[model samples]
Target: MGDKIVIDARGSSCPGPIVELAKAYRNSKVGDTLELWATDAGVRADVQAWAQKTKNQIDSITEQEGKIVVVIKILNR
Candidate 1:
């Protein structure tokens, strides 16, 4: 995998995080990676659902000092 694209949608809530992710995902290709840092806790579930829907892979989702750090790998598109 190449370097990851970081999406820092920290303060945004609800669809904000997902929207940013979607945009990045749309521009990304298979094998491209993304690192998202969100403050909204709902991002975890949102990312999970998006990943499933898009047929992508969630490499990891960890909490670091209240920040939800999500690592996703584009598996298909």
Candidate 2:
């Protein structure tokens, strides 16, 4: 595990969180973890699907106080 890169997408709508996560992933190295904070409910499924499509590893998806926290690890890149 490496230092986590945090992306705060809170208050952002659909595609915003995923876009930020994608950007972070592109700049990250293998084994690096990304923590995305989003307020949009749809981001949960979006992130999951994006991770699968990109072959990245999702460590967890947690929700607290209407906020979503997605943990993803860079596996291929």
Candidate 3:
């Protein structure tokens, strides 16, 4: 099955948005798309690190309405 997960963590603090992204990872599979929206300035670094640790592929990073939007493509482990 195909699926997409979007986590809106805008207004959250450090680690909060990253945590949500991690949670989304648990339920996601290879080829899945997970979009994370975070307002915390640290989210970009944190999420990138997390994806590196977990072997996920970062598809894109964009800024939307003052929030950082990250789209991660789940990679096969």
Relative to the true structure, candidate 3 reaches a TM of: 0.88
> In model 2, which residue pairs have backbone atoms overlapping below 3 Å?
none
In model 1, the clashing pairs are none
The numbered model that scores best in TM-score is: 1
> In candidate 1, what are the lDDT values of residues 50-77, reduced to their tens digit?
9899899999999989998999998888
lDDT of each: 0.90, 0.87, 0.85
lDDT of 3 by residue, 2-74 (tens): 5788999988785588888878788888888899998888888987898889888898999968989999888
Clash number by candidate, in order:
0, 0, 0
As a TM-score, model 1 comes out at: 0.92
TM-score of each: 0.92, 0.90, 0.88
True-vs-predicted CA distance for residue 32, candidate 1, Å: 0.7
What is the TM-score ranking, best to worst?
A: 1, 2, 3
Candidate 2 lDDT over residue span 1-77, tens digit each: 67789999998875578788888888999888999999988888898898889899999999999989999888877
Please say which candidate is ahead in TM-score: 1 or 2.
1
- The 10-residue segment of model 2 with minimum total lDDT is 12-21
Estimate candidate 2's RMSD in Å: 1.4
Query: Which residue ranges in model 3 land beyond 4 Å of their true spot?
Result: none
